[model samples]
Target chain A: MTQRWKLTIEYDGRPFVGWQRQDNGLSVQGCLEEAVRRFSGEAATVHAAGRTDAGVHALAMVASLDLEKQCRPDTVRDALNHHLRPHPVSVLSAEPMAEDFHARFSCRGRSYLYRIVNRRAPLALEAGRAWQVSVPLDAEAMQEAAQRLVGRHDFTSFRASLCQAKDPVKTLDRLDVERVGEEIRVTTAARSFLHHQVRNMVGTLKLVGEGKWAADAVTAALEARDRAKAGPTAPADGLYFTGAWY
Target chain B: MTQRWKLTIEYDGRPFVGWQRQDNGLSVQGCLEEAVRRFSGEAATVHAAGRTDAGVHALAMVASLDLEKQCRPDTVRDALNHHLRPHPVSVLSAEPMAEDFHARFSCRGRSYLYRIVNRRAPLALEAGRAWQVSVPLDAEAMQEAAQRLVGRHDFTSFRASLCQAKDPVKTLDRLDVERVGEEIRVTTAARSFLHHQVRNMVGTLKLVGEGKWAADAVTAALEARDRAKAGPTAPADGLYFTGAWY
Candidate 1:
């Protein structure tokens, strides 16, 4: 007999290739599945709510798996954690779920947080965790300009060239930019996001923050609906998968 | 004639042995001094306001040095940062100071922060940055009990056996513990502290937070004037040098 388990996980993305298994290097998924196999002696497959690119971190990424061993939810969590000691991934929680529940398909919403250290000094403690921009950024201007992107639109200008989405339209529920001390944080949420959508949007907003672009340019780019019309895509280091709403 | 310089530094203390120059391995002080030498070809000595033990971090530690090379403050800051690229230390700022000014003797107050991750799950992102306590801690009770240690007293029970302070009496200006999300942060300020004083106090407070000891027990430990009567010393990973007040 097999049991379905839903899990919430936290990870530091620096050590793995990405959330999915890859041929070239170690992946977060591979580490988790191996831990499960070591703990339960079963070759159960694990699935994630969403896939992330290389060097992108997740705070509360939702995942699901199956097990033939009869064990409590807390026991499953602790045992997996014990086996996963060498990796930078933690099973924060585990719960029994319905047989039909799916981690990727059952999710209703997702949110991301982008961090920028707007200072001239190079980062020491936050290296590999946040992006460092030497120039001073006008956060208030970035906040005002980000509002233009907070609605349903044809986001062709923001989607990656390799995006496999059938449509470029997405309903962006929230796009907020705020300054906390020496850091500028941009947070966004939606039911779903196109490939490289959040990074492209943030890279575009950074131009407005640097006084290189204006609100009019953003509106024009959205209207153009051309991939080449928008700014460059930001680095993967600053983007974090913050949460998922089900 | 050599000129005096005051500097504010930030560092990740994981790689080095400690803040001072050690014979066994690399140190933060040695890195700064070598960076200064490489940048200006001057063999200047870098001095810190407070010496931290192995694996302790700092946000804004104050230091001073003497340089015969003439340069702008910003130039000094950027140039030193450039030379210190490979190390996990950064010079936040550099300022020309009066000849009589000294980082250690002129400091009026010092503040430290101790972080505890109060969760059943192990840490992933905060490894080596915080102390993870698997048992549930009573934050409100801990906060109420922390007030008992805020005043002038002989902290002999909290002093390390290797402490070299001439007197055990010191004025503790502030000691507060608050919970931020899943973390419990304990902040303390004093004119000066005996070796391992902050860690010992935090260790005793952990007993209070765990319900193993009470406020009366804390008072009795203080009045005993013996290190054996107090709780065990906390790990060095949780403590951080927050600031130095002039």
Candidate 2:
């Protein structure tokens, strides 16, 4: 009998091309699938809650796969981790899932964290982990601007040119920005997202935080519903897929 | 007339070899000194509160140099940051110091923070920023055990063999181990420390937290004054020079 499994994987996105498999480079899913195949001798197809873009990281990314194996959950976790050691991918948890549990299709919500170090100095320990902005930012202004984007809207202005969303309309449940010391964090949650919507929004928010754009500019950008109207897309280095609800 | 200047510098230690200049690679001191020379057309010696090792990071690292240049503090900060940008170093603040001020010799205390991620998850964003421990740790027990090594002692058990401390008898003002979620933080404060002292103490405490060694074992190890008596030294990646007192 085939058993479905749910896995929570964590990875440093620097080494891998991205979460999806590509002919030219390595990917988190490809690593996990290969580990699964090596351990169970079955070619398993893994589905993830979010197919994170290249250079985007994750602390707790959910995935599901099916295999015809009698091994315990611990065995699966250990075997995958062993094989994945050569790669940056790590399997944090493994558990038997109901047949109906689907990693992508069943995921009800997703949350992401964007980190920015606000200081005159460049990042050291947080070099790749955060967006370092030497110029001072008004996080309160960013928060106020973020509140304007926390609702259902056609986010074409925030969508990437290559984003393959069936529709540009998405419901953003939350978009909150807060500052801690010299770091400003942008936390976002939504049931679903249009392609590059979060990053594009963050990029525009940066302009607001830097006092380059007023809060009303954000509302006008949304109303424009054109990608060219938004600010530059933020770098992928600071984006993190923190969790997904199933 | 020459003036003594105190510089509060910040740098990303990843690119440079270390705080001290060496023939093999770039150093933080070399970058700052080079910038001073470029600004004043004269070579300057830069002294830091601590000579950090390669790949080790610091925040609020204090340094001092003598300069005869006629410029405002903000001018020096901006000029150095501009020149040091090519070197990943930044001068956060610059001020006139007492003629007798010495960056290292005048420091009264130094504090360091060691981060340990007590989990099986592979680090993506925090890859080089923290040490990961797969084994479950009893943080409270570790905290209780860390106290055993507090106060003044020879600390030879935790001192590295390569350490150059003339005398192992140093007063430890505080040693604290606490848990913040999945991270176990070990904070140490002392007037000065032998090489690898903090890492060594943390390594020994891990044994107590893992149940491999008891709290009494740490006290015995200190009394033994034997390097082999304590646990292995923790990795340097988790260590951070948090602050220094002048």
Candidate 3:
């Protein structure tokens, strides 16, 4: 009997082309699928909750796959981790799931975190993990601006032009901006997001943080309903897919 | 005419042989010295508060150097950082210092942080940055054991045999262990440390953290006055040269 399993995973996204399997280079999904094939002797495809862009990390991404081999939860987790080694991807836990459960379609919510190192010096330890913004940022101003985007709204101005989502409306649950020492962190949650919504919102808020735009400017950008009205998209290095709620 | 400058630096030590210059691979000191040569046309050596081993990292390492070129503090800091590009090193700040000030000899305190990822999964985001101990760790036991190493004592057991310090007896100002989420953090401060002192102590504490030894075992190991009586030296990956006080 085939068993469906849900896997919680973490990875450093620098090496992968992105979460989706592409012909150009390595992807996190491709790596996990290879590990699964090696362990189960089946060419099963693993599905993730989100298709993160290139250089986007994941703290606890959930994925689902079917396996023909019968194994305990611990054995599945350890075996996948062992085979995935040398690559910076880890399966944190594996659990049996009902056949109806799905990693993407059945997901209820998603959360993300973005880190900005606000300093004049170049980063050494956190170079690839965080975005280094040499300009001093007023995190309080960013926090004030972030509140403007915190409810049900059409986010076309913040969404990527290439986004395939049929609808532009998404309910944002949370959008928090805070400063911890030299790093400014932005965290957000939503039932779903149009592609690049988080990064675009962060980039727009950054202008407010730098005092180049007033806090109310974000409202104007959102009301414009045009992608060009919003600020530039932030780099993918700073974005992380934190978790998903079923 | 020479200007004495005190520089605060941050480095990812994985690419370096160590903090000191050596004939082997690249060294952090050698890179700084070369940066100084490129920036100021001087071959002056840079001295650091601690000589971190390979694979170690630094958050705010203090250093001292003499520059014959007269420049503003910001210029020196910025220029040195510009030249140290492509290497995982950065000059965080440069300040004018009195000739009496020295990074090594005049330092009054040194602090270190050791990170342990106490989880079954192999680390992905923190792979090279933290030590992964698959066995569940008892952080409370580790904390109590760590207290035994605090205070003035002959720490020969924790000291590396090749340490050149004349006296093993030194007062440890702090040796605090605490659990932060999945990480077991060991923070310690002292006027100075014997070579590999922090790593050795952390290794010993791991035994207690694993329930393999009682907390009182630390006392016996300290009293033994022999390095062999202590646990094996922990890997340099988890150790960070946090800061130094003048």
**Maximum-DockQ candidate:** 3
* Candidate number with the higher TM-score (2 or 3): 3
Residue A33 in candidate 2 has what lDDT? Answer: 86
Candidate 1 regions exceeding 4 Å error are none
Comparing 2 with 3 on lDDT, the higher-scoring candidate is 3
- lDDT per residue (tens digit) for residues A1-246 in model 1: 889999999998998889999999989999999999899888888988878888889888999998899999899999999999989899999999998888888889999999999998888888888888988999999999999999999999999999999999999999999999999999999999999999999999999999999988998888899989999998888988888867
Can you write out model 3's per-residue Cα lDDT over A1-246, one digit (the tens) per residue? 999999999999999999999999999999999999989899998999999999999999999999999999999999999999889999999999999999999999999999999999999999889989988999999999999999999999999999999999999999999999999999999999899999999999889999999978899999899999999999998999999999
Docking verdict class for candidate 2: acceptable
Reference A-B contact fraction recovered by candidate 3: 0.92
How do the predictions measure up, each by TM-score?
0.98, 0.92, 0.99
DockQ of 2: 0.47
Off by over 4 Å in 2: B9-18, B23-27, B30-42, B68-91
Measured by lDDT, the strongest candidate is 3
Q: Taking the tens digit of each residue's C-alpha lDDT, what string does model 2 give over A41-97?
A: 889999999999888898889999998987789888888898776787888899999
**Weakest 10 consecutive residues, lDDT, candidate 1 chain B?**
B139-148
Candidate 3, residue A103: Cα displacement in angstroms equals: 0.3
Chain B: TM-scores of all predictions: 0.98, 0.95, 0.99
Tell me the deviation in Å of residue A7 in model 1: 0.7
Interface RMSD of 3: 0.6
Tens digits of per-residue lDDT for model 3, B90-201: 9999999998889999999999999999999999999778899988889999998888989999999999989999999989989988999999999999999998999999
Give the TM-score ranking, best first.
3, 1, 2
**What is residue B12's positional error in candidate 3, in angstroms?**
0.9
